[model samples]
Target: MKSIYFTIALLFFVFLFGCGDETPTKETKDEVVEPVLDYYPDNVGSKWIYLNAEGQILTRTIKEGEEFSGITYKMWQAEPPDAETEIWQAESSDSEAEQVFFRKTIAGIRLYTKEIDKSIMKLIKEDFKPLQGWALFNFTVQSSFTEGLLVELPLKPGLDWLVIHIRAAGTLLGGKNIALTLRFTGHSSRKEIITVPAGTFECIRVTYKYEGKLEIAGEIPSSYTETMYVHWLAPDVGIVQIKDAYGTFQLIEYDLTL
Candidate 1:
């Protein structure tokens, strides 16, 4: 009767509320995001020229059979840094003929010619080795030294900045003890905003530290010093220019195909 009816009604309400409680609650899921990396091409072809502190173009192209003859490349009016001026001209030949030219014009004129088997870029990247106590690029030379030259540049996108660590052993000429330790740090822009003579370029920074002495027989004395330079370039923009503590060097002409 009435009592039974009341009990039934209470059971129905309990069942309804219990069913509602069984419903699942809304949950928020975290989305997985991937990191962005810098893009580096397989081969980077560009010509770099050295200038004097006087703002003069001291580097020139000399024919192989020119007056110097056996000289595959040559430069006149070249000079090295001195107490008054600190600058020199060093050129690289991307030929297997093994030829190189170095000149320094200061108190006196000095010129050197050597048969180089590889290009400056190849030599630098091949001979690069990490220091004993340093935190730099964890890179190891692959089977072919050339392969190691082009590294898989890792970058975190949205930073608008990329940093690179370069370490290598430099050769000393004079009897003076050369530490052969150098730390080079460079950066590039993540966004393509800046423009250069070549094209649109990204921002970049380069810093270096030199220890020990470098001496040349009968020319320069051994001394310890540090140097720094900055480069601005991108795939779209070949090479805008470079700014260093000493001076600024601009890209007169650039051709990536070369």
Candidate 2:
């Protein structure tokens, strides 16, 4: 009877321990943690294409790195030829890129100082940085294009921040100069599931509004405003689409040939 009782006790112990709550293994715990997303990958040969509502397509490509005044910058160029290009000088594409140089300045809203040739010099203002980014303005046109944070990493809803701002004086031509100023306010208000030609993605919708004015030496000050909406930044990917008064844009193709 003692031996039988011993066997029953052993079985009871097994049932208590073996059939009880289970403990999670290290691998299972690790599996529950998601990897952080690196939205932008700023590398050579990275390219993006967008289709506008009017069926117009735009292509942007990252080219070889160029050095300027002891600084190296990745050239982001628009294909099929355009008015301006940006000098994005940053170590990682996963974060916001800095603009050390701007090819054109928006002296007037849509009135840029491009066709005027080297008569103008576009430069980052007073070490003025919006969201830690360079603010560009033209010395000749005395105007600005885009400003503030180009891209905000680890995008999430209710994420709001500055993009760019510029206030500078244009060069004197015929004994007259113009004072130009621009302020860009932007934010990522929310997220949505979006579909494009390339594929479907979970994107963070962002918006920017610009309030700017231009004052010529001998004329009354003129004011202008502009707005932009972008909905193409996908998790693990970068900007996939964009929209502005110019047209509505959607991502058609993308490649990170790096």
Candidate 3:
């Protein structure tokens, strides 16, 4: 009887120690680290096709050959606006070297160039003032590129509004359809929170918009008009998507490191 009792006690001790080792401890909610904006990329690249409300392709290659580096972008769009097919291309190397080119069925349409400066951005921020609305905020900037002077604006308003405004200039065609491209830099905000399909994730979003006219001097004496919106979804390291009035393009597959 004594031996049996001693054996039972030893088994119980072993069982208790083994169970303690196998059971996992509950993690405190506070100890869990929520994902930060650092997971988003700084740049985004994509190809897009613009469709009308009926879901018909209205414009071809709206974002083809479009690449966003940091705060700047280059893109082209072609559409059959009238009986003639119109092609437009815009490029911006920095705050400078922004140019716009256009071609229509009409012969001898000239290309225009313009300059973008700080005063333009300030003027835009002050004008077309945006009112906080919905999950987004909207604002416009009066900017000039080689093509002509125009306005750039963001339609969505939300947290980190200014950061989106500054990053946005880089995404504009730099006055691509018009003439010059507006380059925006120098941001003060760092933290961002956004609602994504996966869930609400913290991130830094950059946005900008511009519109203006294009003139080809001594060419087809007509002014071409354009308006654009750009958004860089930066969760942390790089951009997750590049969004415009047409739609959003996912960039995670092209570069996962972001």
| Highest TM-score against the true fold, candidate | 2
**Per-candidate clash tally:** 7, 7, 41
Which scores better on TM-score, 2 or 3?
2
lDDT of all predictions: 0.29, 0.49, 0.28
lDDT of 2 by residue, 146-186 (tens): 22255454456676554445455643434456565655555
| Tens digit per residue, CA lDDT, model 1, 147-202 | 01111134222222211112222333223222222222233334445543334555
The worst-scoring run of ten residues by lDDT in candidate 3 lies at 7-16
Better of 1 and 3 by TM-score: 1
lDDT of 2: 0.49
Model 3: how far residue 241 lies from native, Å: 3.6
User: Per-residue lDDT tens digits of candidate 3, residues 1-258?
Assistant: 223112111111001123444546575324575442232221223222333333434322312233233223323233323111111123242322122332211211122222223333333333313412112123223433333211112111242211111112211212221122223221113446644433454544544322222222233423222223333444342333334444554332232221
Error of 1 at 177 (Å): 9.5
User: How accurate locally is residue 159 in candidate 1, as Cα lDDT from 0 to 100?
Assistant: 23
Candidate 1 clashes between residue pairs 3 or more apart in a chain or in different chains: 78-105, 79-104, 79-105, 81-86, 81-87, 82-85, 98-116
